[model samples]
Target: MGLAVVSLKKGEGRLLKSGGMWIFDNEIATIMGSFVNGDIVLIHDFDGYPLGKGFINTNSRITVRLLSRNEQTVIDEVFFEKRVRDAWEYRKKVVDTRSCRVIFGEADFFPGLVIDKFSDVLVVQSLALGIDRYKEMIIELLKKVLKEDGIQIRGVYERSDAKVRRQEGMELVKGFIGPEFPTLVEIEENQVKYQVDVKDGQKTGFFLDQKYNRLAIQKLCKNAKVLDCFTHTGSFALNAGIAGASSVLGVDASALAVDQAAANARLNGLEDRVQFLCRNVFELLPELEEKEEKFDVVILDPPAFTKSRSSIKNAVKGYREINLRALKLVREGGFLATCSCSHFMDYELFTQTIGQAARSAHKRLRQVEYRTQAPDHPILWAADESYYLKFYIFQVCSDR
Candidate 1:
């Protein structure tokens, strides 16, 4: 079939005009020519001006995810080779390529795809139906590119079982892209070691986006008591212990995660200094408060409370409750590190929520720094969804 042309309605592609990669179904005026869903299609302005090319999926609200802004661009192995190489090259310059986000979906201009490197293993997630069609080619190309840089990828795993795939008319599935190997992978970051369970662990085995954020809290933990809530795999707690913290307690409700966290503590030789607890943070925080327990540093790294905008109000309440409880536990002049991974909760809303929490806890906050996800998870400006993870560190002072 010839290239299908999708023309946008007058003044309907506002987001696209502003440099976003998505073209909604309602924004389309008409489709000229014939093509199947998940096929490459040309985009045209209402006046017949070429806007570029993208993959169209009628099953999703995001009808078209722009692949290239150049109309002449071809989609093939040659095209994917360049994209994969460019992504790897960018990571080498900006982050530790040993284990980092090699391809960050829209941020890397490969919308609907995410690839993370954990030691020698590659974890790939192809969310959109269009990208799923080329997933194999992209993975092979990425392996070739990394090999040129002296990196031998021992295995490739697919974690494309996200629920969102159904929205694109795709099946939920995950397995090895090639021959299966041990799913458990070991990785080191900020001088701390962890065993990542790629097959059954959280997104991409580990949260590589927080790589440097964990590093930032090291100095604050020296010879101090630390508390790390929602400590999946005990990342922050281990960092504290490695940084000479007197003691560290990591809490997570998941028994599996707690066991992994405890194992990680042992792996880092910090089992004595760093400990793991299986408990609901919401219940434990108040219990600790009643016991008058205080910590020199408290880190709240909760999983996203709300995945959609409709639930953002409840998400705010959750963030506020945790931050307030954490502030009350911070000894006078102590530090608190809190962050939200939800994109639905914008920066302004998150900051405002923290301020409310401070007031309720009667703690005066002195802002030390504001941070986002690590550089490897680049925030593409025009693509707002590419920018999540708002992190902040504050000094908590007793209200006089």
Candidate 2:
């Protein structure tokens, strides 16, 4: 088959030359022919020189997601196997836990694909139409790689609930590929045990990316009061309680999540020290403050507020509001660990939002650490968007 061609405008060569893979709608001079969404396209400069190969999507603002910069290379099954094997090798060497992100989209040279390893199971989410088109090849490589490593390959689950999939003109898909569904899976990270529900739990059944950030808070939890906002399954609260915090409170809006959090605390034998509350975090923060409830350590790991450029400003406001309230509720010399998973909100913007919140709350804040996703979730330097996870741990002091 003749290659579908995408011709770039005059200066767009700069973005590609500088290692950017995304070709926005505005960058295209003209698309040579009609291609189905996720079809491979050969990108060319205005001079008609072959630049790279990418996945085409007529529906999205991002028209092309470049797969390889080498113009001569074909994106075949063997090519995908090589990428998957490289991603797997890096994760096995870097990540200490079995439950970790195996491939983090652009970070692993396979943009729009994320894979999480949970013990014997692998959960995959293909966010881009391009990667979705090659799902079979990717899965085949994953199975082969796991088998070669002597790892028990039990099942593969697909969780493509992300809104990006819709933007890519793909339908949501969730189910198991193997014989049996994993009802419950236990994973240990930072000396804490977590039960994951691969069939229904959020984002591949667990927030494995936050493994390091949760452990950072553990060091400061000795005999201190702790509060975990947006506590999906009580990972933070349980860690605090296990670290000898005097008391730990976990709050989340979902009843199922709250129930699961309570059960998780009990599973870790920390029920006596941890409490779970099912309430909206935006409302609960102020209510807790009005009741004169203060905490020595507070964690706010909310869902992504902005999925695209249009919502970034509003998301910043939401981030500021929650951090402002949380900052006010922290006792003097207390610690605050907050995070945002929105790729649209860059690290500078996110930290600036937190700084603005501290200024408004009349609190003195000193950042103790700036963290990102764990090693397994490697961020490719060439693709900045893959570095979406941002975590900041700060020491709070009253201006008074």
Candidate 3:
């Protein structure tokens, strides 16, 4: 049987033309030829002109994910090897390669796959059925590419438990990809040590995307009393401790996270100065206000409050409330570091929300710095999804 061809409705290929990789299910006018789901298919515009090559998944709302715009480019081991090599090279050029996001899904052109390298370990999160079929081959090629410089990957772990996989008819599951090994892996970044449990940790263990952003707060931490809200595994708090903070208090709702954070503090020999509490940040903020508690530095690194467009309204409210509380808790002329990891919380909107929070808290904010996800997790132009993570640092002061 010949290959399948997907013809998009008129003007439907605009996202692809504009450099995005997904083709929504509703955009296709029709699919011809015999092909099953997850098969490579040719895409054409309404005028019958070839668009590119992509993997078709009838079960997914993303009907097809274009792999290449070049009509003749072949999708094989060689293609995957090149993509991995290029991604690794980019990381080597811009960020610390020891622990970084090697392949960031569509950002690196592997439409539905993400690979994060932590020391000698690799964690994979496969999100699409069409791409799932090629995951093994991709991992092999990734290892091969990494080995060119005598670097060896000890193990590969699959964390393909994202709910999006269910939309593509895949079950939520995670396990070692090859030989079994201990899941708790120790890795160091910016001189901070972390014991990452890939099997149970959030999104491939440690949040590598905030690697540099954590370093950005170091200078402001010397001898300061700092508060870290939503402190998963005590990352920001530990960074502050390592930065010579006088005392650091990290808070999280998860007792497990608090335990891990405390363990991490002990691991780094900062247990004396670094403390963690298992408490909801929202409630703790009000209590701190009641006691007139204040910190010389406050960090709010909350999880994504919004994942979809529809939740943005409520997300905005949540963000504003927490930020307003956080701002009020920061001592006058002290630092406030805040961030939102939700892509749906666009840059403009997140910044605007912060401004509203500052006004509501009756405080003035002097912008100190702005940052985003580390370069290893690069943001590709025209691929809006690649551009998440908006970080801001401000000097808070009483209003005029």
Candidate 4:
């Protein structure tokens, strides 16, 4: 049977034509042929002009995720091999390949599919039904490509258990993709070692997007008293300790994360200088301020306060509150590192919110540097979702 054809309404596919990957359900004008929900389909302009090809899923608000702009490009093992190889090569050139985001979903041209490499293990998250069908082939091709580079993948694990799967009419499932190996994988980043629990840890076990950001804080931390808020697994704190910080306090609400972080500190032999505490950072910050406890450097790496645009108001408030308290904890002429991982909190809005926090705290902020997610997690232009992280370092000073 011939493939189904999807035609876009006039002026409806502006995002798609401008290089974005998604075509929303409401933008489609008609389906000219019959096909399964997850099958590949041809896309066309309303005036009978061929546009491209993509996989279709009526269950999703994103109706079509374009696979290629070229109408004749075939979706097969050869095509997948090229995509996998290209993603790997790009990572090799731009970031550390020892452990990194090998394929970053939409940014790497594989919509709704994320593959993170932890040492020799691969954790896969397939979020959309359309790409879920081709996931196995993509993994095989990726493994073959890595093998050619003298890298042998020990195991492949699936973490397609995010809540977003329900929106695609798919059940959340996670387990070993092939043969099982020890889920406890150890990786080294910026000379800091970590025991990443691929089986039970958060978001494929670690946030590799902050890989370089953690490295960027080393110079600012040497011999400085540092406080790392929301320190999951003590990544930033551990980096500080490794950088010769006088003392580091890493705080998180999760006791499990605290324990793992302590273990990581021991792994690096920095347990004496770096301590893990299980406490609410929001409450702890105010207490520290009341006690006049100051830090030479304060790092705020909170989770996304809002994931959607509708709750941005509350998100802004949350961000502002934390930044205000954190600014108060920084000693005069000390440094502050703050970041937001919510794409909904765009660069401008996040920056503005921080400025409000500084004004409210009666502090002057000297901008040091601004950064985003590491090079491996490349931000695809026009595809706004891929550009989620916004990081900034500033020197905090007394208003005088």
Candidate 5:
């Protein structure tokens, strides 16, 4: 079939005009050519001016995901090769090239694909249905690019098991894209070691986006008692222990994650200084408060409370509750490193929530520094979802 044409309503192309790549269903006025859903479509304004080319799907609310603004561009294997090369080049310049996010979906201009390189292994997630069709091509091209750099990806694991795929009318998939390898892979970052379970771990096995943020606590935790809440795999706690913290308590509700954290602690020879606890952080925080327990440093790196904008109200409350409890549990002049991973809870809203928490806890916060996800997880200005992580380190002062 020839390329389908999608025309936007008058004045409805404002977002696409302002640099955003999404063309919502409500924004479209008409489709000029007949084509199957998930087909490549040419997007145009009502006046018939070509805007760009995107993959269109009637199943998802995000109807069209613009692949390129250049009207003359071709969507083929060569295009994907260049995209992968560009992503790699950017990573080499701005991030730790060893084991970082290679393509951050829309942030890397790939729209619906994410790739992470862990040593000689790569994990891929193709979220949107439109991109799933090109998944094989992308994987093959990426392998070629890596081989040119003298890196051989022994295996490619697909973690496209996200529930969001249902909205795209696609089946959830998880397995080795190529040859099978041990699902567990070990890698190091910020002088800390981790055993990433690619087949079963959260969000592509390991959360590489927090690579440097975990290292940011080295100075604040030296010889001090540290508490890491929602410590998935105990990354922050391990960093604190390795940084010479007197003692570290890493808490997580998941027994499996706690076990993994313990294993990582042993792997790093930090078991003596770091301990893992299986408990709900919200429940444990109040219990610790009741015991008048205080820590020199507290790190809150909770999973996203809400994924949709509709739940932002409840998500904000959750953030505030945790922040308030952490602030109250910190020793005077101590540090509190808290963050929200929800894109719905944007920067302004997150900071405002923390302020409210401080007031309620009768504590004052001295802003130490504000950091987002590591550079490997680049935030595209036009694509707001790419800028989800909001990390802030603040000194807690007693109002008393």
Candidate 6:
């Protein structure tokens, strides 16, 4: 196929030169002939000077996600193999264990592909058209890399349920890539044990990116009464219980998730201390307030409310409502671990949203710590915008 040319207007090439990956729709001077989604494009200045190579997706606001700056570099199977192998090499050296985010999109220079390695197995999610088009080759590269690293290849599972796939006109795929499916795998972080279910759980069966934040909660949960809202699979509650919380209450709207949370609590033998509740958090929060129920530690880890710029206002409202209610439900001097995963919502806006929530609830907050995605989920420094995950551990007070 001939190289699809993408000409950027005037100074828009600065972002690309500064190591940014995304080229928004507004940046394009011309689409330059018809090109299908996921086609490799050669980005150039108006004068036809080569800028870089990237994966094109006209459907997305981010029209192109740059893959390489080298004009000679071809984004073929060999190129993908080298990128995937380089990602694995870094993980092996930096990550303390076998389980980690093996591929982190732009951070690894393979835009729109995220692979999480759990022991011998790899769970992959191709969120962009470019990555989806090369799924087979990527899988092949992953297998070769695992074998080269002397790691047994259990299977590669595709967990592409993310909304981005749908936007890219791809169907949701979840299944084993190899012969057999691994039943369970254990991962440890900061002395806490977590059982990951790559086949049937949320987001490759675990939120490994929150590993450190969970451990932070564990330290604060000692002898405390904990409440974990939107407790998918009981991770936060179970961790608190295992960390010696006197009692933990986990609430989620999904009964399936609640059931899984209970099973996980039982698996860790913490069912005696951790309780699961299947209920809408919005309604439950008010009820808890009415009942005068308060917790020493409250976790608010809701799913991303905003996926696009259009939904940002509603997302902020939802976030604020939940944070305000949770703040009210935490005892004075208690801890509130709050988080937002919406990339559209910047950290400053998120902090401001929480501050407004606290103000409306007539509560004061002292931020204890600020956290982001785990190390395995590396952020590209040039693309500061890619650092989407945000966590704030705050101490609630009555000095409003």
- 319 Cα displacement, candidate 5 (Å): 0.9
Among residues 3 or more apart in sequence or in different chains, the pairs in candidate 1 whose N, CA or C atoms overlap within 3 Å are: none
Clashes of each: 0, 1, 0, 0, 0, 0
Give the TM-score (vs. native) of candidate 6: 0.92
Full-model lDDT, candidate 5 = 0.92
After superposing candidate 3 on the true structure, give the runs of residues whose Cα lies further than 4 Å from its correct spot: none
Native-to-model Cα distance after best TM-score fit, residue 197 in candidate 3, in Å: 0.8
TM-score of each: 0.99, 0.95, 0.99, 0.99, 0.99, 0.92
Better of 4 and 5 by lDDT: 4
Off by over 4 Å in 4: none
lDDT of each: 0.93, 0.87, 0.93, 0.95, 0.92, 0.86
lDDT of 6 at 207: 85
Quickly count the clashes in candidate 6.
0
Off by over 4 Å in 5: none
Q: State each model's C-alpha RMSD to the native.
A: 0.8, 1.7, 0.8, 0.7, 0.9, 2.2
Lowest summed lDDT window (length 10), candidate 1: 11-20
**Which one wins by lDDT: 3 or 6?**
3
Instruction: Kindly list the per-residue Cα lDDT of model 1 for residues 89-175, writing each as its tens digit.
Output: 888898987889999998888989999999999999999988988999899899898888898999999999889999999998899
Alpha carbon deviation, residue 240, candidate 6 (Å) = 0.8
In candidate 3, clashing pairs total 0
Candidate 1 global lDDT: 0.93
Decoy 5 TM-score against native: 0.99
**After superposing candidate 2, which stretches have Cα over 4 Å from the reference?**
33-35
Q: Candidate 2's residue-wise lDDT over 206-237, tens digit each? A: 98888888888899999999999999999999
Model 1 residue 192 lDDT score: 91
- Per-residue accuracy of model 3 over 1-400 as CA lDDT, tens digit each: 6679999999797889899999999999999999989999999999989989999999988999989987789888888888988998998899998889999999999998999999999999999888899999999998988899788999999999888788998899799999998999988988999898899988788899999999999999999999999999999999999999999999999998899999999999999999999999999999999999999999999999988999999999999999999998999999999999999999999999999999999999999999999998889888889999999999999997
